[model samples]
Target: MKRIRSPQKTAEKLLLAVMTLFAAVASVIFLLPTVLTITNSFMAQSEINANYGVVFSSVSGGSKTFISEKVNLKFIPDIVSFSQYFSVLFKTPDYLLKFWNSVILTVPVVIFQTAVALFASYGFARLTGKLKEILFFFYIVLMLMPYQVTLVPNYLVADKLGLLNTRWAIILPGIFSPFAVFLLTKAMKRIPKTYFEAAMLDGASELQIFTNICFPMVRSAVFSVLMLVFIDYWNMVEQPLILLNDEQMHPLSIFLSKINTGDTGLAFAVAVIYMTPSLLMFLYGEEYLVEGITYSGGIKG
Candidate 1:
């Protein structure tokens, strides 16, 4: 049997098609930079210079401008080269060292902060009172405050503790992040109290209940926290810059910032490699992130 669509239904379908096409175009426009960075990483040195030499030259006091010269953007290389990748991986020992430094600096923050947030959020969810309300309000206020606002106080504390220039200067401040507490607390509140009551009736201790029940229930939120924390710390520039005086001790984020203007090919390669960890975490944790945020943002008692 064949069914004919009404004119109105056909018009609505055409509208949907147009909207989808518009969105696809918009997405491609937004993703262009990332796509170009990744593709340019494999470009031959000559091709890179041919494409971007004018811009870099302008930065170095040449007279080339976007309006002054014909701009050429390259997504595919005339001849793909792995020299940049090899240089970053083998020829540069410090790049690997700084990459590991980023790993060391980021992993502890993610683990400790998520653990601290989860436990603190569990306590806030279970206990209800005016004092708790006041404290939670403070947490929200602190979370709203900009990172730059706290940077000076944090530096003073680090200086006082003699942790300046050491990884502790970075780790300590990140471990007690307010945003984690706020996010995880919201997730925890969404959990019903009846679950806690049932667990208690079954003689489950607070630790047992937290470990056995609450943690599993909020696994997505935990993953969300880990992803967020990792990305935040992985791309950190200011903390390392302000806290660590020694360039050798800097993370890859700071290292990337110091990339030589002449080494554009190496810079692009490093950028791609540097972006991989956060990319992987985001891809894997994306579903958890969405679900966690949805639950956290919903109305709760």
Candidate 2:
């Protein structure tokens, strides 16, 4: 039997369709420029300027004003080349070194930030005291604060501590993020208390309880934090510029800026190169993040 959908149900379905269409259109609009950049990177710079020729494109033979005459495209190159990519790596070896430097700097920051954040989250969920409340509140406030506000004080502190001009200058500070702790804590607190109580009654130590039960349960959250933090620092620029004055100590974020000054084409190529790690991580771990956010959000509410 065929039955017509009620007006309310029809309206709900229409709204969903409109929402989905909006999302897809928004995504395409955002992604279109990135796609163009990638495609244009494969093109030689001459081709990129071919459009300019289309406007001014005329063989000015002996100063005859001929807008009607079809001009041979002298500026238009016959071929697209990977010259930009080659220049980014070889002609300027700094691009390559900077690319690797970004990798070195970002990897450890993600690791330890995730490690400490997971434990902190567990603590927030499990522990009791006025101290925990105060500390967690402090973390949320700091995390929510602007990065620029913290930069000067952090630099001064690093200078005082003599950690300036070293990789540790950037890395050690990144290891102790408050946002990761806050988000994970929110996720972990959602886990049922009975699980922990049951584990304890069965003779598990606190350490054993965290490793066996808490970790597996909040796996989604930990993974999400790791991905987010990695991408955040991976694309950093301003921090290393302000804090680390030494040319060698400059992470790839600053290094990319230097290349940009030398060559625009090479700069875009570097952007394309530098984006791969974060892009791969995002694509791979999106499922984990979705599950983690849903789990974390619903765990308590």
Candidate 3:
């Protein structure tokens, strides 16, 4: 007999549809700004001016009330143009230099931090003792401490070491990030101890076992760490602001914040360009990110 769904089931389905629609709306709202930025990057100067003119107009008077009666949010370009991109690439040489500065600053931090974390994690996971637990607890505490708490101490150390206003000022602190160590250690500890025992039987050295066995097992975790560390460093502004007094040495992230209202199109173009590396990184490693989360501590005896 073909049975129809009960009224309760029908009501549950209707409620699910409503919740789904709400979630979709919320997602669209969250992503609207990014969407607008990308679309407006291709918009003509006239269109951008037309849309955002009210917000940018200078009210040079006593006690001026800054209130916009109408706000325009544009998602579609009137005419596709590459003028903004050209302006960024060719018209301004400083922007290119700052872009390179970001690359230089971000890449090394990600690589070195991940490497340090990998080795530290191996030691933590393999070394069996209560001392290891105590050390890891300290790492967690350090990781939990906010940047503001550490900033002054880091500044003191950097000044003492004469590393202020240099790339080393930023790189050194980043290379020893506690969060990376914590995450990598957690993943590495999940690895089976039996693997080490088997590898030892073949006279495999610790380094060899780590490279051939531990690394492959924690590949997803490594990818996750890379993506996270890259993103964090890529968007870093405060460290550079405090560490480097010279504006010329600043990364693209700091410059983006200082962009004025007149350079709306240029801002959009720069934004789109800025997001490309992160977007690409996320796309490539998203699967590993999911895998890392899912398979963490999966090999339980």
What lDDT tens digits, residue by residue, belong to model 3 across residues 1-301? Answer: 9998999999999999999999999999998988988998999778888888566665565233556568788788878999999999999888888999999999999999999999999999899889989999999999999888999999999999999999999999999999889888889888888999999999999999999999988888889899989999999988999999999999999998666445777888898888989999898889998887677534634
- lDDT at residue 107 of model 3 (Cα atoms): 92
The stretch of ten residues in a row with the least summed lDDT in candidate 3 is 57-66
Clashes of each: 0, 1, 0
Model 3 regions lying over 4 Å from their true place: 4-16, 59-67, 297-301
1-301, model 2: which lDDT tens digit per residue?
9998899999999999999999999999898767755665666766654522233333545232335544333322457678989887788877777777787888999999888888888889999999999988899899998889898888998999998877788888899978789888988788788989999999999999998988887888888888889889988887778877877766677776555334556665777887778788889999998888778734534
**Which of the two candidates, 2 or 3, achieves a greater TM-score against the reference?**
3
How far residue 299's Cα lies from its native spot in candidate 3, in Å, is 4.2
Worst 10 residues of 1 by lDDT: 58-67
Clashing pairs in 1: none
- Taken over the whole model, the C-alpha lDDT of each candidate is 0.88, 0.78, 0.88
Model 2 / residue 9 / CA error / Å: 3.1
Candidate 3's TM-score? 0.92
Top TM-score model? 3
